[model samples]
Target: MAVVNRRGAQRIRNGHPWVFRSDLERAPAVAAGFVRVEEYTGAPLGFALWSPQSEISLRHVSADASRAPDAAWWHEQLRTAIARRAPLATESNAYRLVHGEGDGLPSLVVDRYGDALVVQLLSAGVNAWTETIVASLQELTGCTGILARNDPAARDREGLPREVRLLHGDVPRVIEVVEHGVRYLAAPWDGQKTGAFLDQRENRVLIGSLARGRALDCFAYHGSFALHLADRAEHVTAVDISAPALARVHEHAQRNGLTNIEPVEGDAFDVLRAWYREGRRFDTIVVDPPAFAKNRNAIEGALRGYKDINLQAMRLLAPGGLLFTASCSFHLSRGLFFEMLQEASADSGRRFALRAITGQPLDHPELITVPETGYLKGALLEAMG
Candidate 1:
């Protein structure tokens, strides 16, 4: 085993859980699948996924080097991951069991919506164990089907071949899963990342409670937040760039016999600006745009984008109405997000009352040291008179 430098070993020892190329003592000619990370003194540190391209460089599989990244280990991890969700009896049917590195299983995610499992093999290490992982998921969860949503972009980053196929069981074109008493048609085979945003389950329920009068869901992909508002609010206008996503939302609403949802297909910023210009006011507005900042460099531009949309949303909100805004950019800190919101309120000349500040569901557990893990942050506030 080639030795990893002192700094990398120290970082792993301190529980940061990733080693970069700069931290290596000597380069080992190991395959992309897995390699042993050791200290300069030849002391074994952990097993890591060796990525030559990404700065993440090495994703630690396990601190214990003895544990091989194979079928037996995967079966055990899959069993333990499923067992961890025993408390969520109803939620188990449609939830994320293994959240990549969050569950100590780096570069792999398993989300079960009813009897179907959506898997994302994000790294060479996980991809190597794909067959075993799929089999274990089926045997452990009794899932009727397993769909590999291995999008090409993520695989290319890992220097692995992109593959999308039904590894095991039966996955239909669209699978139905009930979430908080509402049935959601998840298209794992043909839909977005893992068929649905199961991570936002709890947040959507919270949005349902906050909905009132007319609501606007900007970048409301598939209407998870918008559709939830249908039963709670007077009406909902869902805006997204993807016409197909809007169509899916419309389809979901129609399936549920809901008629109060208005699927609007257009750029969120333009639509918000037009609504503001037309003096079209909403009682509640949710600006849950996709990640604007992927890295530190784009943060300034992303912040400006966030501020502009929020400023417009606040301006179009009626007095005492709500503004539920969020940024999924891990690069954007909670303090910075709050500061942006305050500035947006100031720019809009509106007094804002902070009702609640929330984050991703419990499934997406955030380690204190891993601040990047706690990227999903949002505020539920009311525009005061």
Candidate 2:
């Protein structure tokens, strides 16, 4: 049994899944594998996947110490996760089938893009259990193929190699998914975060409903938001640094018969700044940048970047225009995100009222005890002046 210190035990009791290296009573002999977690006094706490090298030494799999994490156990856990998202399957063919800790499958994420399943084994624990995970996912979703998109940098911290491969069956070059009556082609193997940002589905629908006139979607990877906005907006400008991404956006627009969307290849920060200088304004603006703060040390710079982009976005919004802004950095709390927004609103001299605050869609559930699950923070605001 892996003995956890008092702090770790207390945290587990409170429903937190992570046990840091410092919180362990002593390092286990086995560096990377599953173990029965116990308190220093020898009381069985739970079953956890242990990774000695990583800061997150233990990821609790089950609070029931007696429960063995076998193939059947994994199947049941995965089945429950799938059942939870069953309702969402009706709305969109694309949705997150398993959201790591959110789905009680810590350190592993499996997103379903139609017949293909994109899996990310982000921890040594999950990496060790890849066969079981793949088998269970295949059984549960009956996906035509499982693509291991296990190349996220997070795996480096866990001493796992970054790799992308076909684990089972076959995957197409492009897969089509429909959300809110909009069709999009996603490249699960090539595109970002399992082809598309499934977490933003609800937010996109919400923003699409509020969209009007001209819309600008900055950091518009594959133009998911811009495509939705184009439904109501007179025109939509989708900007990104990658030309291929812009090209994909153009293709998607063409696929949807959406002629109003203009895909611009450029850095979002520069594009927003230049657009503001050009005195170009929009009725709707979305700023969904990649994680500016990779860690807590980068928080200051991230806040500055967030403020800069948001301030420019506010400046570019026409009177009564809607603004949907977001930060994906887990280190940046919801409070800090809002704080930056307040500063941006002040600097832009735009009086705005908060229309709604949003997070990842229902498929990506947030654990009340694990605050990090609430990583994506977004706000919808209406410029009053």
Candidate 3:
């Protein structure tokens, strides 16, 4: 059993599962499988899924140094993860099953949409056990189809090739899914985040319930909130930069026999500014933009962008209008996001009542120890006269 030299031992002891290359004394020739982690003094620490090509050299799978990363261990872990998500299946047809390390299975995320399973491998250790995980998913979920969308940029750091492949039964181009009683057709390859924004399922339901009178859904990719809002609101205008996404929204509305949605394709900021100039106002607004601040260096600029966009949107809100704003950037702290929103509200001379503050859905588990795991932050505010 090859051990994790010295520094790797301390990181493991510290509760971090990753084993970086620099922590090694000398590179050992080991196949992509379970490897022993040990101290320089030759004391065994744990067992990890080993991969030579990944920046995350190993993923700690078991604290007991003897257990191997084999089919039995993989099935056990996958079954446990599935059981945890069993409750979600009742709540929504589209939901995340395994969230990588958050589920104690590093570098692996499996989202279930109806009978199909979408798997993403984010690191070398997970890639090594891909077959095991896939087989277990099929056996446990009785899933008809399994697709791999391992295209995250982080995979490059693991020296793994990005790929989208079908691993099991045939999958349709568009699959019907229902969330909070609203139906949607999610495309596999084309849709964002493994065929639809399952992360926004609960948020859309919230928007639908709160929507009334005139509503606007900005940066509304694929009309998640727009379609739902249109179902209950007097009218809804959905804006997005991607014409295709807007088209999909329209198609979805048509499929559901809904006609209260208006799809607009343009830059969200420009459209919001134009609406403000036209003196057009809405009773409720949903501002769910893409990540503006991906890295720390861009945080200042991103904050300004978020503030500017939000300021324009807030200005167009009629008295007592509700605003649901969100930030998906892990680098953008909740404190910073709230501060930016406060600046926007103050600049617009608006007194807002905070209705709610939330993070991602239950499936997107946030570990208490790792703050980075909590990326999605949101606030529901109402502009009071």
Candidate 4:
């Protein structure tokens, strides 16, 4: 059994599933797996995944104080998470089936891309059940193949080796997917976070629906946003720091038969600054950069970066134009994100209307109780000046 201090008990009671190493009074003797969680006085709290080696010692799995979660219980949780995402079959073939703590299956992430499934066991406790998880997924998804994208640094902290191997069936190097009628390719073998940023699916749809006039997609990695904007916008400028990524953008645009997309190679910050100084304006602009803050220590600088790019984007926004800015940094809180945009608006000296506050798609469920489950947030702003 794993024992926790008073503070840890209170944290679990408050709906937080993480019990830090500092809060853990005693961990289970086993190397890894589920264990009974108890308070200092031996009062049963729940069942949690006991990862003795990681900084997060206990990850709460079930609140059933009486029953320990067995293999059947975990199977049901996986099934429930999969069933919750059933409605998305019609909208797109690519989506997140299991969102770790968001789905009450902590430290386990399963993303589906077309015929393949990409899984990440982020914690030692979850890693122990990799076989069970893969077996259940093969039965549940009936997909062509399952690949383990377990190369995340988090595994290093958990005392697990990093690897990207085919777990079951046959997964291809490249998988094509469609989201809201926009088709794109996913490199499940060697691509960004489960091949693509599935969390931004809804945001892409929202921006595409309202795209018009000259649009600019800053930090357009593989041109996901640019592809959507080109469908409705008169012209589109897809900017990226890497010329190779821009090359992929050109290929994506060409494959989609979108001739209006122009790939621009440059840093988004420098380009935005140059555009505003040159009196260059766009009717629509999307500033979806890579996570500026990966940890708490970087939050201060990340906010500055966010504010600066947003401020420049606001200046380049024509009257009655749209600006869709987003941040994927979990370290940057949603409240802080809104506050940063407000500060940017004040600095821009422009009247901005908050058309919509965007968030993750239906597939990427963000629980209110667990802030870590959610990271993607954005705003659809209109320049009213």
Candidate 5:
């Protein structure tokens, strides 16, 4: 059994899954795999996946110390996760089936894009058990194929190489999925974050309903938000830095017969500034930028970036217009994000009324103890001036 210090034991008992290196009494030289975690007194605490090199040395698998991390256990976990998301299947065929720690399967994420499943192994422990996980997903979803997108930056810290390839069956160039009556083509092999940003599924629908006249969607990768806004807004401009992403946005718009969405390829910040200088205005604006802060050290710079983008978005909104802004950086706390928005509003010199605060969908459940699992943060505000 791997013995943890009092601090680690107390945290585990309180529902926290991570045991950092600093919290350990004595670091064990066990191989990078599952081990039975116990208190210093030799009392069993739980079963954890141990990573000797990571700062997060221990990730609790189950409270029962005797529970084996076998195929049957993983099958049960996959089954339970699928059952939990049964309600979401009716609304959207494209949804997150497993959200790593959120689904109780640490460092493993599986996203369903219709008949195809995209899996991400973010840690060495999960990578070691990849075959079992892929098999379980195939059995549960009867998916035609499974693609391993083990290319996340987190894997680097785990001492794992970045890779993307087919694991089970054949994966076509494009996979179709429906969300809130909108049809989207997800390129799992080539696109970002397991094909698309499924975390903002519900948020897009909400902002879509509030859209009117003209809408601006910043960082509009493949036009997810812009396409949704097309249903309500007279015109929507989807802006991104990647030309390929913009091209896909155009293709997606054509697929949905959404001629109202215009794909604009450029840096979002530069475009927003130019639009403001040219006296361009919009009734609705969505500022869903990529993670400004990848780690804790970048938090200060991220806050400033968030504030700048939000301030520009606010300025672009017409009187009584709505603004939907979001930050995907887990390092940025909810309080800090809200505080940045407050500062942005103040700097914009606009009277804004908060309409709603949003986050990841029901499929991506957040454990109260694991705050990092609740990374996506969004807010809807009405510009009064």
Candidate 6:
């Protein structure tokens, strides 16, 4: 059994899943995988995924102190995770089936695109149970295919090799999915974050509901937001830095039969600044940039980056227009995001009425105790002046 110090014991008991290397009092005798966990004083803690080489030494797997997780245990846990998302069938065919720590299966993320599933085994300990995990998921969901996307940087920290391979049948290069009656494509093999940003599924719906007049989707990746906005707005300008991405936006717009979307290739920051200076206004604007802060060290620069785009967006908002700004950076907390928006609003010299605060939809559950599962945060504001 692995032994944890008082700090680690308290942390796990308080519902946090990770036990750092500094908190481990003793290492397990066996290899990297499932092992019994105990307090330093010989009190049983639980069963955990033990990673010998990882700085995150242990990931709490179960509260049961006696038995290690077996096939049945994996089945039960996965069964519950799949069952919880049953209601999402009505909303979208593409969504998160398992949200890592949110689903109580740390370091394991599963996203579904129609009948195919894309899985990420992020930790060495979790990857050790690859066979059983895949078997359980197949039995529980009867998915047509399973793609193992183990190419994340986290695996490198666990001393594990990163590779993308098919764990099961076949996951196509691209899969079509429907969300709130809007159809889009998911590039499961090479797309960003398991084909697309499923976390923003609801936010796209929200933006569509408020879209009108001239709409702008800054950092418009593949035109997911633009497609939705096109259904409601008269015209939409989708801006991104990549010409290839803008090309895909055109393809997506064509696929959706949306002729109102104009794909523009440019850096969102420069485009927003120019638009603001030229007195260009939009009835609806969405600033969903990629994560600026990947780690804690980048938070300072990320805040500045966020404030800049938001300030530009606020200045470009037409009177009584709606603006939806978001950040997917976990290091940028919700409170910090709000504070940044407040500061951006102040600098824009624009009076704003906060409409709503948004986050991950129903399929992607966020626990207050485990903040890692909840990274996407957004705000809906109305330009009062």
In order, the Cα lDDT scores of the candidates are 0.82, 0.90, 0.84, 0.92, 0.89, 0.91
In candidate 5 the C-alpha lDDT for residue 280 amounts to 97
After superposition, the stretches of candidate 4 with alpha carbons farther than 4 Å from their true spots are none
Encode model 6's per-residue lDDT on 24-72: one tens digit a residue: 9998888888999999999998899988899999999899887779889
Supply the global lDDT for candidate 4: 0.92
- Between candidates 2 and 6, the one scoring higher on lDDT is 6
Candidate 3 global CA lDDT score: 0.84
lDDT (Cα, 0-100) at 55 in candidate 3: 67
Better of 1 and 6 by lDDT: 6
* Model 4: per-residue Cα lDDT over 1-385, one tens digit each: 8999999999999998999999988878887989999999889998999887899999998889888777678778889999999888999989999999999899999999988899999999989988888888888878889999999999999999999999999998888888888888889988999898888888888899899999999999999999999999999999999998899899888779899999999998999898888999999999999999999999999999999999999999999999999999999989999999999999999999999998887778888989998999999999998
* Candidate 5, 1-385: lDDT as tens digits: 5788889999888888889888877666767777888888888887888777778888888988767688899999999998999998889989998988998888889999888899998877778788888888889899999999988888888888899989998877788879999888888998878888899999999999889999999999889999899999999999999998899899999989988998888998889999999999999999999999999999999998999999999999999999999999999999999999999999999899999999888889988888978998889999998
Worst 10 residues of 3 by lDDT: 24-33
Residue 382 alpha-carbon offset, candidate 3, angstroms: 1.2
Q: For residues 272-372, could you state the per-residue lDDT of candidate 3 as single tens digits?
A: 99989999999989999999998999999999999999999899998988899998999999999999999999999979989999788888888776565
Q: RMSDs, each prediction?
A: 2.1, 1.5, 1.8, 1.2, 1.5, 0.9
**Candidate 4 residue pairs in clash (backbone atoms < 3 Å):** none
lDDT computed for candidate 1: 0.82
Q: If both were scored by TM-score, which would come out higher, candidate 2 or candidate 4?
A: 4
Provide the TM-score for each candidate, comma-separated. Answer: 0.93, 0.96, 0.94, 0.97, 0.96, 0.98
Q: Name model 3 segments beyond 4 Å from true.
A: 1-7
Clashing pairs in 3: 4-38
